[model samples]
Target: MQGLKAVLPLLIFVFCVRAKKMRWCTVSDPEHKKCAELAKALVAVLPPAAVAAFARLSCIRASSTTDCIEKIRANRADIVTLDAGEIYSAVKQFGLVVVAKEIYSDGGCILSVAVVRNSSVDIRSLQGHRSCHSGARWTAGWSLPLGFLLSRNYLSWSKEQLLSQDVSTFFSGSCIPGAAAMAPALCTLCQGQKSYIRQKNYHCETSHSEPFYNSQGALRCLRSGTGDVAFVDHLALESIEGSDRDQFRLLCTDGTQAPISHYRTCNLGRGPGAGMVTRANFRKTARKFLTTAQTLFGPRGRERQRFQLFNSSSFGENDLLFKDVTDKLFVLPDDMDVSQVLGLDYVALLKGLGHEGSSLEDSVVRWCCISYAEQKKCEQWALSIKSDPLVCVRAVSMRECIEKIKRDEVDAVSLDATHTFIAGRCGLVPVVTEYYEKERKCVPAEGSTHLETDVLPSVVAVAVAKRSSRSIFIGNLGGRRSCHGHMYSPAGWLLPYRHTLSLEHNSSSPCDPDQVYNSVFWKGCLPGSQGNLCKVCMGGTGEAATKRCADNHNERYYGNMGALRCLVGDPSGKSFGDVAFLEQHNLQANILSLSSTGWADGWTASEFELLCGDGRRAPLSEWESCNLGIVPPNTVMTRPVLTARVYDFLMKSQETLAANPNTEFKLFESQQYGESDLLFKDATQCFVHTSHMTARSILGGEFYSHIESVFNCTHSDILEFCNQDICSIFE
Candidate 1:
């Protein structure tokens, strides 16, 4: 029975599916003394029944680490171990996920240190001494430490310095194998023939024959006095003669000396330990396989051989698929995806080192806001994104935010599709579509009326007027008081501006509709516009003057509701405005709610009319026949230069907010502010991704062309007034 029990776990992989099984690939060199033995011992050490319920394990051998990645992608192998650097490569190039990580007995992360003989040198004063490094472009040896130095402006670096170079010229002489193709000043002390080339026994070559090449090799260089300081990882110290510990000291980032164990604060950076990689789609199965395998054959397992699932020594190469200091495997958090765990800073560092994710420099993305409400929500969002940060920079208005993006002062903003066209003209791109769930009557399979799961109906842009108005005809609309949601809004301003420009008015009247409107509207509440147009605008003032006219509940007359409020003039005074321009959605939301104002106090169903094209008025329900054109939903925008980061930020922020909807603070609507939407429409439920669509495709193409034709008809500079982007700003 004991024998059967032992054999059950061993056959776990073999018996699962029917007791299906999975294959794990290991990079192996037959010539290496421990390679084959380690692989065999691992399988032999498994307690038979450990993985019987879910997975069975099998090992496939590969010639090298890179080969193992290929095998994994080909589906011939499902898992392998990889360093933090290699993990970035596997994720970006091969789409692999990290299932488990190595945890040393001391801690999970390894420290990088600058090692020097006692009383020999100070980190701040090692200007011309000989130095040794593990290798060029490696995390501990180059990227981490050099990145730290470069960030502090301590070294002069060329464009691709970190990846293609050897070292800073502060080192008089050094041995870095890969420098053969880059900085010659760095290889001045190498034993390589002629300071270049990779011939056998070449002095600076990465071969074991090199005096200084890797962690072990760099330490050897220090011991032999070939270099004054050795830049190596923490694991190197354990291999040094114990008695010699007193002779060496580590240089801390603060420029003080410390003992090795104090490395946590003294080190250049943490060498994020290696992890097991498999296709992200197969991560669940892969995680199960690793957890069970480690349970039986790992260092603390019940098996006699005590095979280590993540042992670096198994490769007999100091560093191969995994590092040697690993004492156990740590399953990564279930919710932590590879990119989240790998981190953007590290990814950006790796990009400089010529690894993957180079297209996106890992950095905190900055978002631009034009209102206090948006700024408030941005702060909450910044706090929610604990893994990566979102920074909010303020702009006076939507146009200012778009201009800031053009100037590279900010990274992103959310805009209505009408404004999206303006932003795209300023070189911004669209990242996602903000979809508002519209209320539509539908009948499901059971024949019961219900709302569709996902539906955002198109909005109608309309012109509203009082039934008593008799003289304000469409063509003669020139000098009438006008109420608009905002300057560039499709419903409130842009559409009307364009429609007015498409007419042949009195030659004596201003040809420019924009100028004509400014002169015509004796009383105006053009939210985001300037001057007399802002008179009735209700919002805080300052450099936020235009923002005060923002299209939200804040502005006295803003958005569709605000525009309606403008039309709801005081009963005792002249009607607020002769006409109001806004969307039907806003009109729909406020039909029955008239609490704050007395202008529309007794507005009966028969009193509201839709202003028409021929200077005539139509019934309220006939808005389609008298309305301006419809526009697409609002979009999230960024510059072409920042598409990746902005996309990631919006997608992640949306997901985070969507996941915890019950929170007091939310990303979409400001319930506390009593605003339907601030930065984005309160109507938005989710942001839909249009796989290959772009800003131009969504907004500028037909919309801009139509606006251009309209403005041309009136010989109006309305296009110029709104800065309508008909062509690429770059052009």
Candidate 2:
């Protein structure tokens, strides 16, 4: 947080505005410097109908694709064009969002093709064959073909060796500018032999002086017999189609061959066609900009200008601002995000090619957490579920964890109900939920009637007294000894308190319950409290006493189970509560039984019971009659724009973790034994599957809003603050 201070405050303010004019970033390659001219041309050509909403464009120059991605993230620029491979990086590394894609002139997306001379003998083996590549890591030359082979395990390379070594082994020699720094073998067959060997280190570089570079130059190498085969895109072959059409043959992956123009049927794979991207938050802006650009230059648009919207040759590079093959600014369907645009199998392909480790990461699910304590336990949990282990990544907070998810730094997280809201608001969606088999009833979270269901009931908040006790009931419970879980919890504090305030008590119309609870309860143990409230709480003596037990181990009684334990009291056998307010689950979860963590604090389920209406007592399972309120369960949430990888990963985890017979690795059980629930709830047996529901539906509209209202209240609104009596006592 402190590090943000180094950034200028004015720039932050400027970055936040949803301005009318957009900054369009263009790659500034010195070798192909027409990005400036192309930017002017695009701005000049926008359709007149879009002038009011997006009247102008401010062009920003970026030295490379990586630089352009950075500009988009910092908000110094708004939009840029990228290939599928670069788009993958931009989305994963820079949080860039995709809005529109470049449709080729022929109405087909770009395709990657491998070309060899027609007269070449049936070339079964590429080993020792000289080759020419468009460039390193470009969708056509590298990502598609190499990604295809690597993902299928056709090639093997060690992390210790450069990727160039893998390339060098597959092909005897090559000319690829992208490999100049890393792989010297690729440039071995080049014809250029400049005098200044030191100055022109990569002799086969794509300048006019060098014979080969880019898609065109790589094909030129094939035409001139400089290399036996050329790895390039459909556009590269199209460049020489008229005069030199018979000179090249397309190499298909299945050990077959086709003519140069047979790219549609005989090709490596669909190349990641060029796309325009912007910062994720600017989805609306990017959409407008793309629609306007396409309206001005789409196939349907009036071609008022000499230079076309998708013309890369206008800028001297065949695929400069956009691909040379691009004929229209196509709008992607709303369902197709950048990842989907790349295609699922292709994403796996790219990941395989780029993997630094020898083995595939496809089997592992990287889980996100906010602290070392969680990660420590998660590591052990990972060991238990060895089938598909969890690898942990730590962030500063929940915000950072979601931010990391956006950047592909981590996979998933188990979120609380409210935090799930924040994650959804950040574009994550619910993948799965902690499904307690117990059927719970629920009212609409906001503005509607409750959902209808048969078997599964909602979890109700309840007020419990011993079944043997004959006098206690909901109506005359004032001045009773109370036991409650932590503050702000729905069951323990909010719902029960809401119910208490609604009762027709013999008192003045109460606007505030903080004053009422302290006066009503004879003595209460609400953990994480001080003064008289702590007098009832059982925090052990010594250093733990100094700490406020607001969260977990610091408080002797926390969660629903903790409040129940408080009612039965501790090892000293001192009974504490006349009534315990908590989730209805506590009644059924046998407190007498030994948990994986061991015995339940020297207490038994038989010692306590549920207090019902009219001062009656029922067994724990019959909670439909004696409950305070019910709510939906906790959920597993992810970004709304989820890729198939993440969705499948989570669903697989849900199935694998819950299928264990011996309960050796329980996904719902507490990771920590003695303290409050750590990774998951202590009460949950197994999560039953449910359709993805929003955080609002999960928390219930009324309860969600109630929490919001209480949270929004000022500290001065509390009676404790008014009287200097301490706020913790109210819980």
TM-scores vs. true structure, each candidate: 0.45, 0.45
Residue-level lDDT of model 1, residues 584-643, one tens digit each, is 755644644444333356566477788776567788788777777776678877644345
Candidate with best lDDT: 1
Writing each residue's lDDT as its tens digit, candidate 2 over 276-349 gives: 88876776767765664554454454432644555655444565556666666655555565545764334545
Model 2 / residue 617 / CA error / Å: 5.9
What's the C-alpha lDDT at position 90 in model 1? 80
How high is the lDDT of residue 333 in model 2?
A: 51
Q: Which candidate number maximizes TM-score?
A: 1
Runs of candidate 1 with Cα error greater than 4 angstroms are: 1-15, 18-33, 42-79, 125-128, 160-163, 166-214, 279-289, 304-321, 332-336, 352-731
What stretches of model 2 exceed 4 Å from their correct place?
1-363, 366-380, 392-411, 415-419, 438-457, 466-482, 501-546, 553-555, 573-578, 586-590, 594-606, 611-621, 640-663, 668-678, 681-692, 697-731
What is the C-alpha local distance difference test score of each model?
A: 0.62, 0.59
Clashes of 1: 16
